[model samples]
Target: MNNIDTRNPELEGLAKCPTGIRGLDEITDGGLPAGRPTLVVGGPGCGKTMLAVEFLVRGATVYDEPGVFVAFEETAGDLAKNVASLGFDLNGLIAQKKMVIDHVHIDPAEIEETGEYDLEGLFIRLGHAIDSIGAKRVALDTIEVLFSGFMDHAVLRAELRRLFSWLKEKEVTAIITGEAGETTFSRYGLEEYVADCVIALDNRVVNQIATRRLRIVKYRGSAHGMDEYPFLIDADGFSVIPVTTLGLDHEVSSERVSSGIKDLDAMLGGGYYRGSSILVSGIAGTGKTSMAASFVNAACARNERCLYFAFEESEGQMIRNMRSIGIDLGPWIESGLLQIHASRPTVHGLEMHLAMMHKLVSEFQPDVVVVDPISNLISVGNGLQVRSMLTRLIDFLKSNQITALFNDLTQGGGAMQSTEVRVSSLMDTWLLLGYVEENCERNRVLSLLKSRGMAHSNQMRELILSDDGIHLTEVYAGTGGVLTGLNRLTGEAKTNAAEMRQTQDLDAGARAVRRRREALKATIAALRAEYESELDELDASIARERAQQIALEDDCSMDER
Candidate 1:
């Protein structure tokens, strides 16, 4: 979007001059209107000066477009000293003839009301400065100061129009800064109507935390983002976060990424999808951070870059704590495969934290990102704000094809599946962790609440954290409901004992039946033998009685034969 040749053809009619600042060009669809005057209005200390100066500096340094800074509020030396912290060397640019800074000092005490006041002398000075460096960009710091004591509305409006027309005729893109008015965008209310584009800057404090935002109030002849984007001004200069730029149209990957625990991956049907947003929600002491660290460790083990955002604990503290679970993040940090950014959630507003996350992810180019305990963000913003911020963050990470794992803390005494920030709907996969109390013992349990595009297990498993690592064991479920902790062990033991006793009883019954069958067979054998002996004895007695008859029978048998 920043590239001139690659910008959409529809936006080609309105030529845009790239601001060269990170994320600014994206929201503008290209950048500010080219060869036109843009009014930047803001309250005091709202970064109007910094924004104007950085615009000029970026033009001169990055785009190779020489720019002139006509300052009405500060001298050239003061301007240089003020912006030096942002790494902009005004003296170097001036020495190289790439920039020109001219201070137009206006003293109200010396000013006298003259008939038909016009900025004729100011034009000559500005024109000379523009021509001296062949500047293509010009910035007027606080143009309202030029006519400080003027009370004629007609004169102020006419001169403002004339000045804007002159800049247009010169064909140099100009930025005119103005103080925010009580009821209007600018003090004179007419600057916004006259300029080609108007940008508003706001510095608001919520819960004692300051957050800066930028909004494009109007952009004539161009379609631009109207949302108030969070911007950061630090040592790296201005960076606007285009949170809404990414939508749900990002391409998805079928590839899988491990959840770091072997059985947990099995429950998730091979693991979470690549480029997916996973939410690990649990009550306190349910190993949310440990889960996040495990994912980070797994990612780092693949030689992939990982970024861990720790809001509750410092980097060293997290590293040391994770070591207890056999997850030593120190080596990954030392190898440059992992970066741990630790800061209290209250240190900045939710949007600022979102902006910093965007910035770090862009710079680090990590394959996986882990935000430990995203619930801490609730301290800075309401539930809706946190949800919005997380939605944007998830979209941003998905758009970049970075797998993100967020640790969310679920409040106790609430629905086990519900998270305090209510961002569960934004996650592609949600793993709910909590304590399952049974038989006078509390045991950590994990269950797959939901996983998009995969068959996930709904059964709860006992989550065990040992010295070696995390382990997931199947909990015992029976007529007594789901059993965990010592109850599960006891149930298993009882089942085993019952099975063993049943086996022993069956063995004894089979032995007794075999013994009875053996005895019966022996008795039958004895009875048959006794009958044979009786028959033999009867035959012998018959033989004795029939001995005489046998002789007679033998004679008869011989006669019959």
Candidate 2:
């Protein structure tokens, strides 16, 4: 582990620029180079522009490093307004002479490309902007915009090399954003080879799920995170979550927390370990929320702070419905043991949601956290982002020893079967709940799919909600099978009971037969012993008679013997 000092040398004696984005600096080993050109290449809507703009905004506000942005796409005013939502005061920074934004509009129709044209004019303009603010950071959005008026590949390629060399000579850390092609990263084709560092951004949709990924293609003289990390784009800007290492260093706790349901807690190996994450996955209306609410209430009942982020249901509705199920969240909220944050998945970017979650986790420092239906969050992000966000969230909770419960909604179809199979592999513990149809009745059923580092009962149980709260019945084996719906489970339970009674009757009959056989054996043994005793007495009498006759004879026979 190479620990590079990130403190600012100019102010407090350090030489690093913290991007102000979480999880990104850790991957870069510190941050981008202090005074070198780094290329940001990605397809359209890959957040290339937003990332560059954020770098400048953070530099100006956080580090006091004055910066400049040369925009070849949006207007200066538009750029400022677009990022205003993120709490970036671009106009104020520019007014204070701490930052400068130059919108360069090139018209290909007006210019004639008759001969080789040099980019000296572009250089002069950028130099003037840099000198005006004494900027340490510069961003040239879409450097390929210069190629709009010219078709000559040789001239454009030569000028591209010159532009990179000039930025290095100027000693300013520059970010040159370019439009990436489907086959190659950038349309210019030269940005990849010329820049000191090449970063690629990609936006993809898998199974109707959209996600954004970032990969550091190359970083000269430094080893960086080579994997494609998932990132979110929201009102606060872009945030990347670096994948965590799975090592023995992960902290384990001996403490335990209740599952809210007494029986369920007993089912677990003496309740879930503190800070362990449990996954509750099921089809819709399988009592996922009810189970999660019970857990939250249980935690709060113990005076432990808990956070519930609801992505599917409204807070008011959730609270009201939970009350019907015998969970009183009102008192917990009043006592400040429980907090519920409800929002729409599409309201903001996934990164913003993660930031909010991070913010909440930091502020509340809860002992327990619940994400009501994590699958809904996956709907908003791409598969990679979904996986990435989940991995980070799980690791964060585990590290803090905060027990987390996630509710995942599985679709009820063949297509959903594949998705569930994929998701099941990521969970530490999986609780499957669903509706089963048996005897022309639909009933709720719950079962444990798997639990890591522990032994769990392999039984399909009936789930019942009553005044006593949630209840789980013993393993039910129906005529059809053991893993059936609630009615079938109940039927199976009855069938098992009947079979058990029949088994007991058969055992009693077998015991009676064994008792009869033992009595006959004792009677025969007694007869044999009596007969042998009589025979011995008779033999003695015969000897005595012979002795009397023979005592006269046996006495005579004893005399003769």
Candidate 3:
């Protein structure tokens, strides 16, 4: 969107000059109104000058459009020196004939207010600078100096009107900076209406904390963001972070990614979907960082690059800690598959951090991104800003199809809830990690709170961390409640004893039945043996009687034969 091409038909009627500042082009739908004057009103030290300078510098560098900077309060050398740290080589650009810096000092004490006094000299100088470089952009840094130099309002107003009209006639997009006044957009209260666009910059100390913000007051013939956006002036330049885009229209991925823990993946129904937001909420010492590190390790193991944002712990500290748990992230870091970026939550404002995330993500183009303990951001801003920043971050990651894992630290010992970030609804999977105190010991338990578009497990498992890695175990439940530690062991022992007794009784009963069958068989065998012996004896006795009878009837048998 920042690539506002002059040949682009969509931007023909509404010619937009791309600011090249991060996130500002999206807020403006392209950039400031092209070939028209825009009034930038802000108090002292509110980055108005910086914004204007960056616009011109970026125009010359990125857009290949020449620009001229007309400074009335500061010298050309000072202007160049001030923006040198931003990596803008004004001198180099000037040498290349891409940019022109013309400083016109307007000191009220040195100027003489005479009749028929006009800014013809100033106009001729500005016009000469523009014509010399064929510039398409111009910046008049703090035009309020004109009001200070001229006493008569009518003369200044008429000249200002003519100058603005002349700028439009020149067909060059212009930025006119003005000093903000009490109850007025500008000190003159005229530039705001004279320009086609008006933008307000504010830098205020709220509760002793400084914050810089920007707002688009008006833009003729265009739709622009009206809400106050937090902007940052860092080494890169002015970066406006607009409000998070609201909608669920982002494309989703059917691909699944491991949560690093095998049991956790099973609980999540085969792991989190790609381009999904995962929330790991737990109290201090509940292993939130460990979970996040495990996920990073898993992503790296798959040869996928991961961006790890460490809010509390330093990168080395996190690596060492994970190594203690037998999860070696050293290999991933060495292989360039994992990038651990550590920063204190209070190091910068929330929007600045958000912008930095965007900068890093765009550069790294990682497949997975992890923010360890996002709840620490609550210390930097209110709930709304935190939520907005995270929402935008999630949106950005989703747009890039990057899997996001957020480790959240919350207050311990309460009803299960989302982190202080309060973005549970935006998460695709929410895992609740808390402690279950039993037998004077605290045992960590993990459960799947929410998993969209998939069937997830609802059972709470004992989360055991050892040198081997994460392990999920079934906890013994009894009359009181779920049991763990020695209580769980005692319960298992009693269960084992009962099972052993039942098995012994079954074995004893089988032995008794076998003994009774053996006794009955032996008795039957003895009775049959006795009957056979009796039959043998009775046959022998009959044979003896028959022999006696045969002896007596021998003579009769011979006669009968």
Best by lDDT: 1
Position 89, candidate 1: lDDT = 97
After superposition, which runs of candidate 1 have C-alpha atoms over 4 Å from their true positions? 1-12, 113-116, 149-153, 192-195, 248-255, 300-306, 315-320, 323-339, 355-367, 395-401, 527-561
lDDT of 2 by residue, 114-182 (tens): 766777888899999999989988998987887776687677778778888888788888888888876
TM-score of each: 0.86, 0.70, 0.85
| Candidate 3, poorest ten consecutive residues by summed lDDT | 2-11
Model 3 lDDT, full chain set: 0.87
How close to the true structure is residue 184 of candidate 1, measured as C-alpha lDDT? 88
Q: Judged by lDDT against the true structure, how good is candidate 2?
A: 0.80
Which scores better on lDDT, 1 or 2? 1
Tens-place lDDT per residue, model 1, 1-561, is: 467666666566688999888778888888888889899999998898888888889999999999999999999999999999989999999999999999989897877776776767888999999999999999999888866756676777777788889998998998899999999889878564455899999998777777788999988887888899877787778877776774479999999998788989999889889999999999999998988888888888989999999888899898899899898989999999999999989888886788789879989999999998899998997786677778888988998999999998878999887888888888999999999876678899998889999998889999999887799999999767789999998888999999999999999999999999999999999999999999999999988887888788889989988
Report the CA-based lDDT of candidate 1 relative to the real structure: 0.88
In model 2, the worst 10-residue window by lDDT is 6-15
User: Cα RMSD to native, each candidate?
Assistant: 4.8, 9.2, 5.1
Between candidates 2 and 3, which one is better according to TM-score?
Answer: 3
Tens-digit lDDT string for candidate 3 (1-561)? 556564476646888888998878888888999899999999999998899999999999999999999988789899899999888999999999999999888777887866778889989999999999999999998777878778987888888889999999999999999989787888888554465799999987754456788998888888888798887887778887776534567899988899898988887778899999999998889888888888888999999999999999898998889888889999999999999999998887776788789889989999999998789888888887788788888988998999999988888656567577788988999998898886688988888888999988878888888896787787787665787767788988988998999999999999999999999999999999999999999999999999999898988889898
C-alpha lDDT (0 to 100) for residue 30 of candidate 3: 89
Q: What is the C-alpha lDDT of each candidate?
A: 0.88, 0.80, 0.87
**Once model 2 is optimally superposed onto the true structure by TM-score, how far is the C-alpha of residue 481 displaced, in angstroms?**
11
